[model samples]
Target: MDDIKRKYVIPGDVITTGPYRAEENVNLVGDKIIATTVGISEIYDSGVRVIPLTGMYVPRIDDFIIGIVKSHTSLSWELDMRSCYPGILPAQDVFGRDFNPKVDELTSRLKKGDLVAARIANFDRSRDPLITIGDRDLGKIEEGELVKISPSKVPRLIGKRGSMIQTIENATKALITIGQNGYIVVSCEEPEGLLKALDAIRMIDEQAHVPNLTEKIQEMLGSNSE
Candidate 1:
């Protein structure tokens, strides 16, 4: 079904007038679905929502994120996850349960300016979010070009059932690590392929609300989706 429709909207703009359920960044006022933020408004079957063009990422438990090591103390490393609060990776999580602040320096493993792939372990309004890199897939990012896009556009970039990402990967041979927080790391063995992949990602960031985006990206990559 061609149930998806999108358009730019501003605060208080009437996104639609119907029985559509108001979702994120939108409010239902009587029969109208009103935009509660400046962004692209989406109308799908039975639902209406606004994908904000500007906003901070809100960390959620188990959300995979890309973070830049900002600083470290004796026992913990602070990372910038492009969110309101810094992500804290405790020494124990990285250095094992027997970690000692005196003998195990945080910088020994992760220094400032280093990038990492991690998951949000826990968070609450009262404190900074805690992150963990204990999982094999979660750890220091050794290489790749880091790219940032609005967090709201992440879903569109991923597309339905990982189709968009798979399309890009298959065509360009680029390994893309997508962060739920919108920080992406893309790498490829061939320089031309890398460039193409990066361009496709930028295209998505700029035009996520536009329809037929997967087709557009496929054209940009000069290949068909597998």
Candidate 2:
């Protein structure tokens, strides 16, 4: 954990000799806990966990995200989620309405260029990442301007209990939806509002690790408002 804390660690790096509660992105080899994936470890009194700094979005259970439909097969749709591999959005995972490839045109319901907001249903190493859009909040996005940022900065952009995002929303009066995989959508009637929200998101992504990030964003917004 010491080596992992100060510097970067690669896969198979021995994380701990003692019994450790293995957290995200790690594996166990013999009696030692090893890093299965590349990430940094944060050791707390209770346990040690990995925080990935760089890598594509590895879909985990229940991760809400936005994806662009790339192609669709007879059974499912392939989505580009900024990952090494595309995610699968099965017809069964669609909201109350289901499209049938046998009879109807799948592209009509969800075209190749359409943007969807969904959640990671399952992600097996052997299988393509599965996503579900059954929830009320999950569905097709008709209109919005999109932006991309580093996924690692998502938690910070959201802030404590969603304070950071709320600030940007209130200030800009734009409807903003964030995807854990780094895609963000902002919709507003006024073009100025959309630009402001995009600017705020840029600031958050670039300066998330800095101290008083929320305050800095607030001041920036204040001056811009003036």
Candidate 3:
């Protein structure tokens, strides 16, 4: 099967299957199984299926994320995540208690101008991503510098089950938090470590197809140190 036929079909591409039938395939990109003819047909072209370029953020449930706290009420906090709509993180969701604390107490816990790591709890028909901090691991970020990238680039940064993040952490001695919306938070004791972490992330964003990226990063760091 050709990559285009197997993965996705672009506009103006000719696909045929039915007896003496030819149809121009339109722009369709995804994991959807497209039928070329009434009966299943084999793909003629083979290549990597690439999604068309677009500027949009599609929110998913339970995605680990980072956002800045914009405003806070007695119950919830508003966050600015550079999306079509702002996200909301409620106090009960984060604190796990119904007892409303004083303004100062709440500030001490999670205040305005603070960066937090949370999870997507739900979304309304408007597609506004609602965040939560009910879990132990999902809560206020203790430390880190927030970095932003295109939401589409998250898959490349995460790699497989944190393999990429762990590799960078080990090499540069920096802690990293990757958000589904393409926000990165890096933390390290030394400025040099933070710089190394930033450089490694930029490299991954630029060259995602390269295998063994962790090893390549190590080599680059070693040469620079010398």
Stretches of candidate 2 above 4 Å error? 1-20, 25-41, 95-99
TM-score of candidate 1 versus the correct structure, residues matched by position = 0.88
Residue-wise lDDT of candidate 1 within 43-63, one digit each (tens)? 888999988988889899999
Over the stretch 48-114, how does candidate 2's per-residue lDDT look in tens digits? 6776666777688899999999999877889999988798998766634555567765676798979
Give the top-scoring candidate (TM-score).
1
Better of 1 and 3 by lDDT: 1
* 167-223 per-residue lDDT for model 3 (tens digits): 788878888888887788999998998998898888877665567876787787766
Model 3: per-residue Cα lDDT at residue 121: 89
lDDT per prediction? 0.90, 0.83, 0.68
Total clashes for model 3: 4
How many backbone clashes does every candidate have? 0, 0, 4
Sort the candidates on lDDT, descending order. 1, 2, 3
Q: For model 2, where is the 10-residue window of minimal lDDT? A: 1-10
lDDT of 2 at 166: 96
Candidates 2 and 3 compared: the better one by TM-score is 2
